[model samples]
Target: MSFTVLLEFQLKDGVENAPEILREVLAQTGAFAGNEGLEVLIDDDDASKLIVVEKWASVDARNAYVAWRATPEGRTVSAS
Candidate 1:
């Protein structure tokens, strides 16, 4: 079956830079091989809460992507 991943980021009090951070993060993540698409959603009641919805082609694809993210190379690139 197709896989969906939901990543939620809860910001600390008064952190006002989520847009910039999301732009960078989404760009990198959306470029992954298995990513069918990505969407960023904001909480209706709280501006500080954000959710990233990722659609993957398949469960294998999603698992592979998650495994790659644990590698040193993935860590380095993701930190940029």
Candidate 2:
């Protein structure tokens, strides 16, 4: 079965560089193996809130990606 990951992020006030950070993180996410697609959605009522919808080929693939995100390199990418 396909796997979907929903991530939510709340930006700090007046964070002007959020767009660049989002682009970079999403770019890295898209290049990950087994990724079907990743969509970034902005809340209609809240500008500071963002939702990331990620689709993977399978639950295993999603789990693997989650595991990788705990590693040093993955943490670096995530922090970027």
Write one digit per residue (lDDT tens) for candidate 1, span 1-80: 67788999876765466566667667867898878999978999997788989999998888887787788855522222
Task: Give the alpha carbon lDDT tens digit for every residue of 1-80 in model 2.
Answer: 77789999898777677777778778878888889999989999998899999999988888788788788877633232
Q: Please name the candidate that would achieve the greatest TM-score relative to the true structure.
A: 2
RMSD of 1: 3.0
Model 2 vs. true fold: TM: 0.81
lDDT of every model, 2 decimals: 0.77, 0.82
lDDT of 1 at 57: 90
Error of 1 at 16 (Å): 5.9
